[model samples]
Target: MAGHSPADGPGDGPGDNRGDDRGDGPRAACVLCGEPTEYPAEIAGSPLCPRCAWQQAQRSACSG
Candidate 1:
Protein backbone atom coordinates (compact mmCIF):
# COMPACT_ATOMS: atom_id res chain seq x y z
CA MET A 1 0.00 0.00 0.00
CA ALA A 2 1.01 3.64 -0.42
CA GLY A 3 2.54 5.63 2.41
CA HIS A 4 -0.68 7.68 2.78
CA SER A 5 -4.30 6.55 2.62
CA PRO A 6 -6.87 8.02 0.25
CA ALA A 7 -8.94 9.20 3.21
CA ASP A 8 -5.95 11.25 4.35
CA GLY A 9 -6.27 13.75 1.52
CA PRO A 10 -4.27 16.95 1.06
CA GLY A 11 -3.77 19.15 4.15
CA ASP A 12 -5.04 16.39 6.43
CA GLY A 13 -1.91 16.17 8.55
CA PRO A 14 -1.77 17.03 12.24
CA GLY A 15 -2.50 20.67 13.17
CA ASP A 16 -3.63 21.35 9.63
CA ASN A 17 -6.68 23.55 10.09
CA ARG A 18 -6.21 25.38 6.80
CA GLY A 19 -6.01 28.80 8.45
CA ASP A 20 -5.69 30.64 5.15
CA ASP A 21 -9.47 30.87 4.93
CA ARG A 22 -9.55 33.08 8.01
CA GLY A 23 -7.82 35.91 6.14
CA ASP A 24 -6.87 38.08 9.14
CA GLY A 25 -10.38 38.28 10.48
CA PRO A 26 -11.44 39.34 13.96
CA ARG A 27 -10.46 37.59 17.17
CA ALA A 28 -11.37 33.93 17.47
CA ALA A 29 -13.87 32.44 19.85
CA CYS A 30 -13.07 29.67 22.28
CA VAL A 31 -12.63 26.38 20.49
CA LEU A 32 -14.49 24.50 23.18
CA CYS A 33 -17.34 26.84 24.12
CA GLY A 34 -17.48 29.27 21.21
CA GLU A 35 -17.22 32.26 23.53
CA PRO A 36 -15.40 35.45 22.61
CA THR A 37 -11.64 35.14 23.11
CA GLU A 38 -8.80 37.65 23.19
CA TYR A 39 -6.59 35.73 20.77
CA PRO A 40 -6.58 36.32 17.05
CA ALA A 41 -8.47 33.75 14.98
CA GLU A 42 -5.57 33.57 12.56
CA ILE A 43 -3.38 32.01 15.20
CA ALA A 44 -1.93 28.60 14.29
CA GLY A 45 -3.58 26.62 17.06
CA SER A 46 -6.87 26.66 18.86
CA PRO A 47 -7.64 29.64 21.09
CA LEU A 48 -9.62 29.33 24.29
CA CYS A 49 -11.59 32.02 26.05
CA PRO A 50 -10.82 33.13 29.59
CA ARG A 51 -13.35 30.80 31.18
CA CYS A 52 -12.36 27.83 29.06
CA ALA A 53 -8.70 28.47 29.60
CA TRP A 54 -9.16 28.51 33.34
CA GLN A 55 -11.25 25.37 33.21
CA GLN A 56 -8.71 23.61 31.02
CA ALA A 57 -5.89 24.55 33.38
CA GLN A 58 -7.88 23.16 36.28
CA ARG A 59 -8.51 19.89 34.47
CA SER A 60 -4.85 19.48 33.59
CA ALA A 61 -3.73 20.36 37.10
CA CYS A 62 -6.03 17.80 38.64
CA SER A 63 -5.25 15.05 36.13
CA GLY A 64 -1.83 14.42 37.66
Candidate 2:
Protein backbone atom coordinates (compact mmCIF):
# COMPACT_ATOMS: atom_id res chain seq x y z
CA MET A 1 0.00 0.00 0.00
CA ALA A 2 2.82 2.40 0.72
CA GLY A 3 4.21 2.03 -2.85
CA HIS A 4 0.82 2.60 -4.53
CA SER A 5 -0.26 5.80 -6.30
CA PRO A 6 -3.33 7.08 -8.16
CA ALA A 7 -1.34 7.35 -11.39
CA ASP A 8 -1.01 3.59 -11.47
CA GLY A 9 -4.69 3.09 -12.33
CA PRO A 10 -6.74 3.90 -15.45
CA GLY A 11 -7.90 7.50 -15.96
CA ASP A 12 -5.46 8.45 -13.22
CA GLY A 13 -2.26 9.01 -15.16
CA PRO A 14 -1.09 12.14 -16.96
CA GLY A 15 -1.94 10.64 -20.34
CA ASP A 16 -5.43 9.66 -19.30
CA ASN A 17 -6.27 13.11 -17.94
CA ARG A 18 -5.13 14.87 -21.13
CA GLY A 19 -8.16 13.66 -23.17
CA ASP A 20 -8.18 12.08 -26.65
CA ASP A 21 -4.91 11.70 -28.51
CA ARG A 22 -5.28 13.44 -31.87
CA GLY A 23 -1.53 13.96 -31.97
CA ASP A 24 0.33 16.99 -30.68
CA GLY A 25 -1.94 19.77 -32.01
CA PRO A 26 -4.62 22.18 -30.94
CA ARG A 27 -8.16 20.85 -30.63
CA ALA A 28 -11.57 22.33 -31.31
CA ALA A 29 -15.11 21.06 -30.98
CA CYS A 30 -17.73 21.02 -33.75
CA VAL A 31 -19.52 24.30 -34.37
CA LEU A 32 -22.95 22.74 -34.73
CA CYS A 33 -22.64 20.02 -32.15
CA GLY A 34 -20.41 19.81 -29.11
CA GLU A 35 -18.20 16.84 -29.96
CA PRO A 36 -14.48 16.51 -30.56
CA THR A 37 -13.42 16.83 -34.23
CA GLU A 38 -11.08 14.45 -36.04
CA TYR A 39 -9.60 13.89 -39.51
CA PRO A 40 -9.50 17.63 -40.09
CA ALA A 41 -7.69 17.18 -43.39
CA GLU A 42 -10.47 15.14 -45.01
CA ILE A 43 -13.25 17.44 -43.91
CA ALA A 44 -14.31 20.80 -45.34
CA GLY A 45 -15.48 23.57 -43.06
CA SER A 46 -15.07 20.88 -40.47
CA PRO A 47 -15.71 21.21 -36.79
CA LEU A 48 -19.27 21.52 -38.06
CA CYS A 49 -21.92 19.99 -35.87
CA PRO A 50 -22.86 16.48 -36.97
CA ARG A 51 -26.42 17.53 -37.79
CA CYS A 52 -25.30 20.35 -40.11
CA ALA A 53 -22.60 18.30 -41.83
CA TRP A 54 -24.97 15.43 -42.46
CA GLN A 55 -27.48 17.79 -44.07
CA GLN A 56 -24.79 19.30 -46.26
CA ALA A 57 -23.66 15.89 -47.46
CA GLN A 58 -27.19 14.87 -48.24
CA ARG A 59 -27.73 17.98 -50.31
CA SER A 60 -24.52 17.48 -52.23
CA ALA A 61 -25.30 13.84 -53.03
CA CYS A 62 -28.82 14.71 -54.15
CA SER A 63 -27.60 17.45 -56.50
CA GLY A 64 -25.02 15.20 -58.11
Candidate 3:
Protein backbone atom coordinates (compact mmCIF):
# COMPACT_ATOMS: atom_id res chain seq x y z
CA MET A 1 0.00 0.00 0.00
CA ALA A 2 1.17 3.54 -0.67
CA GLY A 3 2.30 5.19 2.55
CA HIS A 4 1.12 8.63 1.41
CA SER A 5 -2.34 8.43 0.00
CA PRO A 6 -4.40 11.61 0.40
CA ALA A 7 -6.68 9.83 2.86
CA ASP A 8 -3.60 8.74 4.78
CA GLY A 9 -2.01 12.19 4.69
CA PRO A 10 -2.89 15.52 6.17
CA GLY A 11 -4.25 16.65 2.78
CA ASP A 12 -3.71 20.00 0.97
CA GLY A 13 -5.22 22.82 2.88
CA PRO A 14 -7.46 25.36 1.08
CA GLY A 15 -4.79 28.07 1.04
CA ASP A 16 -2.00 25.70 0.03
CA ASN A 17 -3.19 24.26 -3.27
CA ARG A 18 -0.03 24.66 -5.26
CA GLY A 19 -0.71 21.67 -7.53
CA ASP A 20 2.43 19.96 -6.34
CA ASP A 21 2.99 16.20 -6.50
CA ARG A 22 4.24 14.07 -3.64
CA GLY A 23 4.54 11.03 -5.91
CA ASP A 24 2.47 9.31 -8.60
CA GLY A 25 2.42 12.43 -10.84
CA PRO A 26 1.44 16.03 -10.10
CA ARG A 27 -1.71 16.97 -8.18
CA ALA A 28 -4.03 19.97 -8.24
CA ALA A 29 -7.31 21.07 -6.72
CA CYS A 30 -10.67 21.38 -8.48
CA VAL A 31 -11.41 25.05 -9.10
CA LEU A 32 -15.07 24.50 -8.33
CA CYS A 33 -15.07 22.16 -5.33
CA GLY A 34 -11.49 22.43 -4.02
CA GLU A 35 -11.04 18.68 -4.57
CA PRO A 36 -7.73 17.20 -5.71
CA THR A 37 -7.47 16.29 -9.39
CA GLU A 38 -5.55 13.54 -11.19
CA TYR A 39 -3.70 16.04 -13.36
CA PRO A 40 -2.10 19.36 -12.50
CA ALA A 41 -4.10 22.57 -12.61
CA GLU A 42 -1.46 24.21 -14.77
CA ILE A 43 -2.59 22.03 -17.65
CA ALA A 44 -6.20 22.95 -17.12
CA GLY A 45 -5.20 26.60 -16.65
CA SER A 46 -8.18 26.91 -14.37
CA PRO A 47 -7.37 24.86 -11.26
CA LEU A 48 -10.07 22.33 -12.09
CA CYS A 49 -10.18 18.73 -10.83
CA PRO A 50 -10.25 15.70 -13.10
CA ARG A 51 -14.03 15.43 -12.93
CA CYS A 52 -14.53 19.11 -13.66
CA ALA A 53 -11.85 19.12 -16.33
CA TRP A 54 -13.45 16.13 -18.04
CA GLN A 55 -16.79 17.82 -17.85
CA GLN A 56 -15.36 20.97 -19.38
CA ALA A 57 -13.71 18.95 -22.10
CA GLN A 58 -16.98 17.25 -22.91
CA ARG A 59 -18.73 20.56 -23.12
CA SER A 60 -16.21 21.84 -25.62
CA ALA A 61 -17.33 22.26 -29.24
CA CYS A 62 -14.19 20.64 -30.61
CA SER A 63 -14.19 17.00 -31.72
CA GLY A 64 -10.46 16.39 -31.92
Candidate 4:
Protein backbone atom coordinates (compact mmCIF):
# COMPACT_ATOMS: atom_id res chain seq x y z
CA MET A 1 0.00 0.00 0.00
CA ALA A 2 1.23 3.46 -0.79
CA GLY A 3 0.30 5.04 2.53
CA HIS A 4 1.13 2.05 4.69
CA SER A 5 4.32 1.51 6.61
CA PRO A 6 6.11 -1.60 7.85
CA ALA A 7 4.34 -1.29 11.19
CA ASP A 8 1.02 -1.57 9.32
CA GLY A 9 1.94 -5.02 8.11
CA PRO A 10 1.36 -8.32 9.91
CA GLY A 11 3.20 -8.91 13.15
CA ASP A 12 6.61 -10.47 12.55
CA GLY A 13 6.34 -12.75 15.60
CA PRO A 14 5.40 -13.00 19.23
CA GLY A 15 5.70 -9.86 21.44
CA ASP A 16 5.02 -7.72 18.35
CA ASN A 17 2.58 -4.86 19.02
CA ARG A 18 0.85 -4.95 15.66
CA GLY A 19 -2.83 -4.82 16.65
CA ASP A 20 -2.92 -2.07 19.24
CA ASP A 21 -0.78 0.41 21.10
CA ARG A 22 -0.58 -1.77 24.21
CA GLY A 23 2.59 -3.79 23.90
CA ASP A 24 3.21 -6.97 25.87
CA GLY A 25 1.18 -5.62 28.76
CA PRO A 26 -0.61 -7.75 31.37
CA ARG A 27 -3.63 -9.73 30.21
CA ALA A 28 -6.97 -9.16 31.88
CA ALA A 29 -9.33 -11.75 33.37
CA CYS A 30 -12.67 -12.41 31.67
CA VAL A 31 -15.52 -11.13 33.78
CA LEU A 32 -17.89 -14.01 32.96
CA CYS A 33 -15.66 -17.11 33.04
CA GLY A 34 -12.65 -15.89 35.02
CA GLU A 35 -10.38 -16.87 32.14
CA PRO A 36 -7.45 -14.79 30.98
CA THR A 37 -8.08 -12.60 27.93
CA GLU A 38 -5.94 -10.92 25.27
CA TYR A 39 -7.11 -7.53 26.46
CA PRO A 40 -4.58 -5.39 28.20
CA ALA A 41 -4.96 -4.14 31.77
CA GLU A 42 -5.59 -0.54 30.69
CA ILE A 43 -8.39 -1.52 28.30
CA ALA A 44 -11.71 0.11 29.03
CA GLY A 45 -14.72 -1.76 30.47
CA SER A 46 -14.83 -5.50 31.24
CA PRO A 47 -12.96 -8.11 29.21
CA LEU A 48 -14.19 -11.51 28.03
CA CYS A 49 -12.22 -14.58 27.03
CA PRO A 50 -12.39 -15.83 23.44
CA ARG A 51 -14.92 -18.55 24.31
CA CYS A 52 -17.19 -16.30 26.33
CA ALA A 53 -16.92 -13.55 23.75
CA TRP A 54 -17.94 -15.95 21.00
CA GLN A 55 -20.90 -17.18 23.02
CA GLN A 56 -21.91 -13.65 23.79
CA ALA A 57 -21.74 -12.74 20.11
CA GLN A 58 -23.87 -15.74 19.25
CA ARG A 59 -26.44 -14.78 21.83
CA SER A 60 -26.59 -11.25 20.52
CA ALA A 61 -26.88 -12.44 16.93
CA CYS A 62 -29.73 -14.84 17.70
CA SER A 63 -31.67 -12.63 20.05
CA GLY A 64 -35.04 -11.21 19.02
Maximum-TM-score candidate: 4
| Predicted structure with the largest lDDT when compared to the true one | 4
Residue-level error in angstroms, candidate 2, position 3: 55
Which residue segments of model 3 deviate by more than 4 Å?
1-27, 39-45, 62-64
In candidate 4, the residue pairs with backbone N, CA or C atoms under 3 Å apart (3 or more residues apart, or in different chains) clash, namely none
Instruction: In angstroms, give how far residue 53 of model 2 lies from its true place.
Output: 2.9
lDDT for position 38 in model 4: 85
**lDDT (10s digit) by residue, model 4, range 1-64:** 7999766668755546445643476888999998878888778999999999999999999997
Model 4 earns a TM-score of 0.60
What are the RMSD figures for all models against the true structure?
A: 8.1, 8.2, 11.0, 4.7
Candidate 2, poorest ten consecutive residues by summed lDDT: 37-46
Worst 10 residues of 4 by lDDT: 14-23
lDDT of 2 by residue, 1-64 (tens): 8988777766734466655555746456687666666634345664765667888799999996
Encode model 3's per-residue lDDT on 1-64: one tens digit a residue: 6576565545565435553455555577777888877665456476776677778888884766
lDDT value, candidate 2, whole model = 0.64
TM-score ranking, best first: 4, 1, 3, 2
Give model 2's TM-score versus the native structure.
Answer: 0.33
TM-score of each: 0.56, 0.33, 0.38, 0.60
Task: Give the poorly placed runs of model 4, Cα more than 4 Å off.
Answer: 1-23
Q: Local distance difference test, per candidate? A: 0.77, 0.64, 0.66, 0.81
